[model samples]
Target: MDLHARLKTYLQNNPEAVGKVVDYNAGTDRLFPLDLTAANTELTTAIIADTQAFSNWVSDKLRANNCRYGIGGYMEHRTIYAVSSHFDTEDEPRRLHLGIDIWSDAGTPVYAPLAGKVHSFQDNNNQGDYGPAIILQHDLNGLALYSLYGHLSRQSLDGLSVGMSVHKNQQIATLGNNQENGQWPPHLHFQLMFDMEGNYGDYPGVCKYSEKEKYRKNIPDPGLLLGF
Candidate 1:
């Protein structure tokens, strides 16, 4: 199925996350939009430049202006689901994206949207992968589920263990910079998964467009909660 169809099915099955939520056009109104500027070489160069200077200047600039930096691209930017480099292989195949990303400055605090237990934690520690990451297992309506928070600082996972309890709105992780993070501009890769497939410490946040059906079954749109 296509992204639209898959997303609709997931929401219909998982109403508690999507039901009666505040409305926010999250993909729109972001500080930056990931477009051809991001797809082209010139902008890639500029991004490298910005990444180089990000720690010393960018963070302060966003905070000083009191701007709530966004985590994903704007709706006008035409963000599409493609297999990320993290899982691409000529010997094998590619995997596509399962979640929407919001591009924001680093060091921003990531909050737990609801109370849950720390299901697992890991330092994925590879280029184009989640750096320091954590997943929380939530019991909603007697249904077991999980939320994955990616691109976090190493400090975020310190003292955190599998099965640890986390409170709602609790500060779990501080967003990391590019050096410690997965070498992209700072952003959170938040994903919701119904079945972990017995996986621990890592899960495919991206899947192949061709295999969208299989992945969409396991991963659901995070906006069902955050879009509120």
Candidate 2:
């Protein structure tokens, strides 16, 4: 079977394997979708270029909405990525977000949605990078899947080794501060991938806009697991 077929089977056979990814364990809070895409003129003017101001803007928005978290940007074309050379190119830029981000304050603990072993972990210390990232490999009735937790605190990577066991709902890492999480507002850049594409410690949570169709196939809607 192909990647999509396998994904469908995985979701069908193991509907309850995954659990909460962030502080919202119920997965049914007052979650709002944020627009960091090029279309938001207010955002363009509000954030400016200050990282603290950007973080403040996110926190203020969540507070104003009475929401604990703001979600969205899966396969979204965002302009905020311009802060880093990693996402830039002389030609077409890589503004297409391939992951679902859960925006919350720094030091917020991140949990494992399912029992799995660490596939890899690394501190990708670069501008607009994952900073500290961990990928966990899991098998549900013989279907192999991987979950990526990105933008973690620097201490999260300490003492972690490949193949370390992590159980469901286990506190694996905390949301990194700006300095550790690649100079962006704090959030978990969570992604589910059928294949690693031979990458380690990191995967393309954001991709080139032209390749959106290709990435969407292997990367299923994370809501299937998050449930909200």
Best by TM-score: 2
Top model number, lDDT: 2
lDDT (C-alpha) at residue 187 in model 2: 91
Q: How far is candidate 2 from the true structure (C-alpha RMSD, Å)?
A: 1.8
User: Clashing residue pairs in candidate 2, if any?
Assistant: none
Minimal lDDT window, size 10, model 1: 74-83
TM-score of 2: 0.93
Which residues of candidate 1, in runs, are more than 4 Å off? 1-33, 36-67, 73-85, 91-95
Q: Please, what are the lDDT tens digits per residue for candidate 1 over residues 88-121?
A: 6566444356665655657777877667899998
Give all TM-scores, in the order shown.
Answer: 0.71, 0.93
lDDT of 2 by residue, 113-178 (tens): 888899999999998899999999987677788899999999999888999998988899999998
